[model samples]
Target: MPKLLLAGAGHAHMAVMAAIPELVAKGHQVTAIGPGERHYYSGMGPGMLGGTYQPEEISFPVRDMVESRGGVFIQDKVARIDPARHVVILDSGHEEPYDVLSCNLGSFVPQGVVACDNQDGANGPGAAVASRSVFPAKPIEQLWKARQRVHELTRDHSIRVGVCGGGPAALEIAGNAWSAGRENGGNGCVVQLFTGGKLLRNMPERVCRLAGKVLRKRGIEVVEGSYVRSVQSGEIHLENGKRYVQDVIFLALGVRPSPVFRASGLEVSEDGGLLVDQCLQSLSHPDIFGGGDCITFVPRPLDKVGVYAVRQNPVLLHNLQAHLEGRSLKAFDPGGAYLLIFNIGGGQGILYKSGVAFGGRAPFWIKDFIDRKFIKKFLPNAPSETH
Candidate 1:
C-alpha cells in the first residue's frame, strides 16, 4: 500500500480531496495537512470582510471534507520538508513520511516590501507585525479579523483607513474596508488607496480608469504614484518623504511563494518557489509535486491567481493518481485567457476577460453567483461522487 501526503489544503487540492474515496478504495492511505480547520476562498475574502457573505458561506471546512471522504486530515502547518528522508516536518514538530508528496502551500503577502524595513511584516500563518498593528492581506482568514477591527474603530469616531498596494487584491480590500467601517452604527470612515504606480498597472487602461472612477465615487481617495517605503505605528511613509497617519492599515503589498522550499534547500525558482516542469513535478525530486502559488512553472512563470490554481486541479488529480499506479504522467496546460473580476464592494465589481471589460451591478451579481457555485462543491454535504 502507498501513502499520499497533501501538504496544504489550497485550491489545487480540492479535486484531489474530492477523489479521495477512489484513492482510499485502492488500498492506499491519503492524508492532508493544513494550518487551519477551514480553507477560506480568496476570491470571496473581500466580500466576507464587507459582510456580503458570512464566514460559513465562503469557506470549506478542510477536516470535514477530507474525513467525510475517508481521508485523514491533520490540523497543523508544514514547517519544512526533509525530502532526503521523504518526510515532512510539521510546525508542531511531528514528522510524516510519504511515498508521494504534493505541495499546495500557497503564497503570503510580503510585509518587508510594505514596511520597506527588515520588519518582514508579510502575512504567513496569519501573523501581524510586532512593531505595528498592520494586517497583511494573505492567508485570507485575516480579512475577517480586519473587518472586526474596522467595526470597533468606526463605532466611536471617524476612522482613517489606509490600503497599500496597486494590485486587484489591494483595491478589493480597500473597498471592503470602506464598507465595513460604514455599517453597524458606524460614524464617518475615510478610505485612501496609495499605489506605487498606476492603479491596475498591468491591466488595460480603460479598466484602470473605470475602477478609479468607481472608487472615488464611493469616497475612497485614490493616491496614485505614491510608493510606500515603510509603515510603523499606523503611519504610512512614502519613498518621496510624504507621511500619512491612519487609524487602521491593510497591507496588500503583493504575495510571495512560501519560503519552505528555499529554506529546505530545494531547487527553487528566482521567486523562491519550487521549480517544476510542465508535469508539475519538482525538477530535483521526482517524488515531489506542487501546484497553485507555491510552484513556478519552468516553461513560463505563472501569475499568482486563483484561476491558475483552479485550472491546475484536474491536472494534479490525474497526475498524482498516475504516479502511484506507475503510469505515464500528463503535462499541465495553463490554457487561454481567464476571467478576472474585482469585488469593489457595495454591490459593485469590475470584470475583465478576453479584452472585454464591464462594471456595475451585473458584474457583481455574476461574481457572487460564480463564487457561491464554486464553493458548493466542497461542502460537507456535497455528494461523494468523483468527477
Candidate 2:
C-alpha cells in the first residue's frame, strides 16, 4: 500500500479525509497532520465572530473523523516539509516519511505588516516597526483571544475602535464589532474603517456600495484614499500625515502564505503561495501537493477563497491516488463563477454568485443550515449510512 501524508486539516484535507475510506479500499495508507483538535470552517468565521454561531458550531473535530477512518491522526503542526527526503518534520522533532504528501497548510496573518514595532518602548509581536498599535488578523486563535481582551479592557472606556485594511476580513471585523458593541451598551464606539483604496476594491462595485451603506448605517466611519504608514504610541499614522488615536486597532490586511514555506525550498508564487499546477501538485516536487489559501492555481488568478479549496478536493484526491498508482492524473477546472457569502452581523448576510447578488436575513439562515449540516456530517454521532 502506498503511504500518503496529509498536512493541515484545512478545507481540502477535510474533503480528502471524508473520502478516505475509498482511498483506503484502493490500498493506500493515509495520515493527517494539523494543529488543532477541531477544524474551523473558514466560511462561517465571520458569522462566528458575529455571535451567530459558537466555535463548536462552526468547527468539526478532525482528529475524531480521521481516526474513525482508520487513518493516522497526528495532532501537531508541521514544522517543515523536506520534499527531497519525502518526510515531514513535525514541531516535536519527529519525522514522518511518505510516498505521497498533500499540503493543505493554510496561511497566517503577516506579522511584518500588522504588528507595530516597539517604537515607543512597547514590546509585542510587531516590535521592529514604528507601529505600536498594530494588530495581526490571523492565527484565528490568537486573534480571537486578542479581540476578547480588547472588549474587556474597553468595556468602560469611550472606545475608539479603528480597523485597518479594505478587504472582506476588515469589513467583517468592523461589522461584527459594531453590531456587537451596540448590544453591549457601548454606543458610539467610534468604529472606523480605513482602506488605502476603495473598500472591497476587488469585489464588484455594487457589493462595495452595499457594504458601505451597511457600515454607515451602523455608525462606522469610513476613510478611503488613506494608506497606513506606521503606528506609534497608541496612534495610527497615515501616509498622508493624518493621525488618529485609537483605543483599539484591528488589522484586516490581506493574507500571505506562511513564511515557513521559504525554508522548505518549495517553489512559491510572487505572493508567497505554493506554486501548483492544474492537479494541485507542486511544480518542483511530484510527490508534494497543495491546496487551500497557501496555493494559487497557476492557470487562473481567482480569489484565494475557501471555495477553491472545496472545489479542489476531488481533484486533489484523484490526482494523488493516480500518481501513487502510476496512472495518468486528471486536471481540474473551476466553473467561471462561485458562490460568495458575506456576513453582515446580526443574523444577516449577503450572497453573490454569477453576477447575481442578494442580501437579507434568509441568506443567513441558509448559511447557518449549510454550515451546520457540514458540522453534523463530521460529528461523532453522524449517521453511519454509507454515501
Candidate 3:
C-alpha cells in the first residue's frame, strides 16, 4: 500500500482531506499534518473582522474531517523535508516517511522584512500573536484579533489605524478595520493606508480607479509612493524617515511562500516557491507534488489567489490518485477569468470580472453569496444567515 502524506490543511488540500475514507478503502495509507484543527477560509476572513461573519462560520474542521474519515491527523507542522530519505521532519523532531507527499503549505506574510520596533525583541515576533497590536493579514485569524484590539483600544479614545502595502489584502483590511472600529464606540477613528506606490497597481485600471474612489469617500487616507521601512507597536515608519503614530497596525504586505521548499534545497522560484510543472509536480522531486501559493506553476505562473487554488483541487486529486495507482496523470487548466470581489466594509463592495468592474451593495451581496456557498459546499452544517 502506498503511504500518502499531506502537509498543511489549506484550501488546495481541502478535498484531499475530506476524501480520507475513499483513499483508505483503496488500500492507501493517508496522514495529514497541520498546525490547527480548523482551516479558516481566507475569502471571508475580512468579513469576520468587520463583524459580518463569526469565526466559526468561516472555518472548516480540517483535523476532524481527516481523522473521522480513517486518516491519521497530526496536529503539528512540517519543519523540513528530506527528499533523498523520503522523510518529512516535524518541528517536534519526529520523522514521517512517505511513498508520495503532497504539499499545500500556503503562503506567509513577509514579516521578517519589516524590522520590529521592540529592540529587545520582547513581546513581539516569537511571542503570542493575539497579545500584540501589530497584525498580519495572511493568517486570517489575525484579523479577528485586530477587530478585538480596535474594540479594546477605542474604548478609551478614537485611535489612528495604519495599514501597509497596496494590494487587495491591504485594501480589504483597511476598509474592514474602519467598520470594526465603529462597533467599539470609536468616534472619528482614522484609517490611513500606506500603499508604498500606486494603489492597487497590479489590478485593472478600472479596479484601481473605483477602489480609490470608495476608499477616499470613506475618509481613509491613501499614502502612495511612500514605502514602509519598519513597524513598532502603535507606529509606522516610512522609508523617507516620516513616522506616524497609530493604535493598531495591519501588515497586509505581499505574501511569500513558506521557506520550507527553499530550505530543503529543492527547485524553487525567484520568490522561493517550489518550482512545479503543469502537472503540479515538483521539477526536482517527482514524488513531491504541491499546489496553491506554495507552488510556482512553470507552465504559467499563477497569482496567489484562492480561486486558482480551488480550481486546482480536482486536478490535483486526480493526478495524485493516478500517480499512486500507476495511471496516466492529467494537466491542470487554470480556467478563464474568475469573479473578483472586494468587501470594502459598510456592506459595500467592488466586483470585477472579464475586464468589467462595478461597485455597489449588489456587488457586496454577490460576493457574500458566493463565499457562503463555498463554505456550504464543504461544511453543510455551517450557518447560512448573513451578518
lDDT of 1 by residue, 231-320 (tens): 766688888889899888888988889999999999998889999999999999999999999999999878899989988988898888
What overall lDDT, based on C-alpha atoms, would model 3 receive against the true structure? Answer: 0.86
Over 1-387, each residue of candidate 2 has an lDDT whose tens digit, in order, gives: 799899888887766787777778889999999798888887777665555666777777889888887788999888888888889999999999999998888887654433444536555545543442345566565345544645564567657778878898888778776665555654436788889888888888778877877887777888888787755567777889999888667777788876556778888888778888987888988888888898877888767777788777778877888889998887878767877778878777777777777777876787778777766765654643222
Off by over 4 Å in 2: 114-135, 184-188, 380-387
Residue pairs of candidate 3 with colliding backbone atoms: none
Record all residue pairs in model 2 with backbone atoms less than 3 Å apart, i.e. clashing: 116-126, 116-131, 117-127, 117-129, 118-127, 131-231
Tell me each candidate's TM-score.
0.94, 0.90, 0.94
Worst 10 residues of 3 by lDDT: 378-387
lDDT string for model 3 (307-334, tens) is: 9989988888877787899988888899
Give stretches of model 3 more than 4 Å off: 117-131, 380-387
